[model samples]
Target chain A: MSGRPLRTFAVLGFATTHTALAAEQLLRDLGVPVTPIPAPASIGNGLCGIALRLEPGDVERADTLLERAELRVAARGDIEDV
Target chain B: MPASSSPRPVAYLDHGATSWPKPEQVVHAVTRALTDLGGNPGRGAYAMALAASRAIFESRRTCAELLGVPDSSDLIFQPSCTAGCNLMLKGTLKPGDRVVVGSMEHNAVARPLEHLARTGIEVVVVQGDRTGLVDPDDVEREVRAAPTRAVVCQHASNLTGTIQLIGDLADIAHEHGALMLVDGAQGAGHVDVDIGVLGVDAYATSGHKGMLGPQGVGLLYLSPDLDVRTQVEGGTGGGGSESPDMPIERPDRYEAGTANTPGIVGLGAGAAFLIAEGARQHRRETELVYQLIEGISQIEGFRVLGPPAGAPRVPIVSAVHERLEADRIAFALDRTYGIAARAGLHCAPWAHRTIGTVDCGAVRLGVGWGNTSEHIGLALRALREIVTS
Candidate 1:
């Protein structure tokens, strides 16, 4: 954990800040427990540079929740630890 | 007991400007913002700032849902409908670009486009018919004739309350490779707005109008594909604060500096209330509008303007007098009968000219959800007495 990247954490990007915030809210409401944070520059495109962070192993579950809610995710991938 | 008799209740019929007596939730939400949420939104790392940010986002989400926007971030806050218009018109139109706008457009859209026109943008004014309705075919003909960059029109005529065929107009604009911009000031909060179905490039409305939000707040919905150049630039407080350029992100790219957090929160609550109440408010307002139209039509010297009876429209009605001045009748209705109504050109001189009321601007009575049959009756009685006496 010294200088490596955020491994195991899934950064879910969205087309806009509000949609990402909505995703975070819906995920938490569904017990997925996510936070809205700034996706790193190296990460894929996201609206307003905002992203939803999910627990290391909760990526798939979070995707299911978002899909069930009809929320679109721009990009979802594990943090590339440097 | 005096049977709870009090002074006569003023019949407020100026809602076409800004609705009054907002839903209770709006009042509570604003109060909560002033009390519970206190901090610079997106400016600090403190819990209070985070809470403030949450309120702002929540408000945006509510507006997005109400407008049926596909992505919430594409919509941002503006000080008023006028400001939103400036952003859309100025941000999109360039020198020598031709833009087409409806004859019934209010100053909010007309003024900005006019300024652009002076600065080398050509603004083509499409005339409306007698009913103040802009024909989509006319717009199509204009677009097909000119090298137009965008077609702008009001969803509903504030002067005559005639709702235009926006989806039809938008389709026409799209067919000619023109972006469609809709000034939704008289629409939105009054009727159901589905931006996706309407297929507009940009739609703007004042929150204080049909939405029942407070003043100093407006909403703009833009499709994700259109890149509207930002008009205002400053600290977004999101990221890239050090960079001189505004962020490429969605709302932060548009929202500069601080915002009216409390007012916007109130707007969100108001929208949420309307959404929950469903279409009951709309149905009530429609019925009252028809009643007002019929009752006013029966008045001997009065001529109710707009689409005739049985034609679909908003709750707004404008009537010009044959023997009396419009302002004089409006003043009598207000001073004598305690009915609040708007008179004059209603910031739409062109619309008056289209409806043949430019010589003597008409009096407008805009009913809203808060009005009832008793209020309408009082207004009708006042009109009858004013014309006869």
Candidate 2:
């Protein structure tokens, strides 16, 4: 068994930077390890300024939380690096 | 009115125009935002930009709590209440769509509806009572008569200080398949306003009036269910530069262009003040309003407008003297008594017409967070002297 989690990550993009920050706060409060980073140019297609980077394993929980908070996800994709 | 070496003390009572002498916390927040958080929020990912974004988010959250909006992102910042009203009206109503309104609206709501009427939208105005209070039954009748797209009404009258039955109106609007939009310019901080409890679809209010913030910033809350079309379009700082359309998001869909960061920061402080001291402030202002109304009614030629003393109304008391012009009385109050009051139509000619004061207008004494019993007493004495002399 490996002690560390996988290096693969998923990105969550929003229509505005404010919503991304809001999601970061909400997920962080819920104990979901999320990092805010500039949305990858390829993933956002120039739609959002920032995106949330979290382990691919926690993607479902984060999506549920955002949905519960009424925040719409504009773009989502997988990324290899920070 | 040349410059004088020694300035006379002022008793500012024109809060309906916009509150004066903002709280110390509000002033400091504006200065702090200008100095420390000087970044274009939502534009960059750096530390300064992130700090600015945090400040704006905190403000939106505080405003959401105060206004009873469940989602902070649903509240959009606008330049003024008028701008919010324009966005709500023009964005929601289309050609041939009808809206029901009351006669007690400020020019903020009326003028926009007027312009919309020119574009083929039908504006149906229901008459209010002499005190500028609209009967919900009348609103129901109008809404029932036609296929109304929305019911637009002011939560409180600036000219008369009369509070309308918003809950009842909202019910009527809902039953008739119409949306309820409120112009809450005079009611947000002075009265208890919970958009969810009131069941309104939209509310537009000025930050400076009841919220005790600086001018040039306002709030508009849209229900999650309603989707209003975007009115203004520009860089929202959320990217999407290649597309001509605004992003399909909660706030970015509506809030385009750069924001008033300093103004929003100041409003956050103002909202915080209201949350902490609102109850005590409301009680004090209510007492003072009754006193002003009763004392002014005793004057020989003065008759107060709006609800009677001891009735629930905003802290506004407008009076018309039998012999003097309204503007002249306001001038005398300003120069001789150092009491600031508003006169004439108060930017609500339709309201004056409804109250039968269109011919002479009324002198309005609007109380706010800064008024005191001593100030009210001085205003009473000054009015007695002005009327008798």
Candidate 3:
């Protein structure tokens, strides 16, 4: 468990066409880590607008943050440390 | 269809359906089979024909070993899992016989059993839990209700990647004097399957899927004690006779027409690769799956489907946002993010109904041997972005 910092991503559930802008603001206000990585063209995990990078130990805290923001979190997972 | 106007780099994650970017060895074996061993297998005693026959025999032997079946000749190669399933269903069941199948079966097994149902075969569907795990007792109850001729279940669900308890179900089938047929379309190469220990009478598998082979090749394993009659007939090289019927031999009796020699050769090489990789692949895949499940469960309003954490399941996972249609999410993932995943019914409507995903289906991510840790991370990041937007 005490290895490299685990890069994690987070999804904020499905956003309405109208509320999408508000959702982005909400994600930022919640202090969710944002990464500017390009999406791969062949995987189908659930995501909408924002992605977060976190240590593996911080995943539970990230969940709590999203819940406090009233954002519906969808999925989170570790990425290769890049 | 024309090639893409502007090609973009994509990470393939649909290995449970069919592997993309096949290993070089698989391609080379297929090429060599077509160029060097391009003679009818088991038809002639010439050098080329003998080589072709050897290739076919070796492929069967490899498949038998992978499935943990002792007798190599008991394995028969067919065009696909659908054909193998049809042969097993039609050849084994008589009119008025009863069959028990899991609610999570693919169309290959479901459609054939449904077709047989019209012809006097009674089909009973055993329900699975919301996570797609079926209780062995439920299957046992179904079998005990009547004289069940066969019990059909999938080793892993293509939709949810939920692994079934085949050994327990097989024991129940045996106790009730019924044969068990397992659809291993999503199981074979992605996970380790021991047909002998599972006690299944027949195990049908697709080569193009988890096996990482070319299309048009599949395998069907029959237990030594199960007396499954042949449903198809054609020339099988030996036992020359004027009658145009199936041969009395083992594989020849079931394998009708000329074989896909190249595809089978490729399949053999793919199986060899899996063996070389060893069982560590399963551990790696399961680790990825656990990481994925743990990550996704934290997402509010994002209900994950299939088995819970610590469940014995494959790397395949399905989830959907409460407010989004599964297909809509799938289309966006592919079109905007370049993430390839399967959506909709996944060819098992009964499973969808059982899991309450019939209306919008489920967003399915089936990881393969070729997938890397970076690929999983990238997928998760993209999914978060898509859902948030």
Candidates in descending lDDT order: 2, 1, 3
Give the per-prediction TM-score of chain B: 0.97, 0.97, 0.95
Q: Kindly list the per-residue Cα lDDT of model 2 for residues B33-109, writing each as its tens digit.
A: 99988988887777777788889999999998998999888899999998999998888999999999999999999
| Model 3: lDDT of residue B52 | 74
Better of 1 and 2 by TM-score: 2
The per-model DockQ list reads 0.17, 0.50, 0.01
Give lDDT for model 3: 0.74
For model 1, residues B1-389, the per-residue Cα lDDT tens digits are 11234434378888998887778899899998999888877655356766777898988888989999977888889999889888989988999899999999888988888788899989999999999899999999999997889999999999989999999999999999999999999999888999999999999999998999999999888888988999899876654544688877778788887878899999999899888974999999989999999999999989999999989898899998899999999889877777889999999888888888989999999988688999899999999999899
Worst 10 residues of 2 chain B by lDDT: B1-10
What C-alpha lDDT does candidate 1 achieve relative to the native structure?
0.85
lDDT of 3 by residue, B269-309 (tens): 88888887748777888888887777667766678898878
TM-score per model over all chains = 0.87, 0.94, 0.79
Candidate with best TM-score = 2
Error of 2 at B5 (Å): 5.1
lDDT of 2 at B128: 96
lDDT for each residue of candidate 3 in A15-66, tens digit (9 for 90 to 100)? 1111222233444566655432222111223232223344556556656765
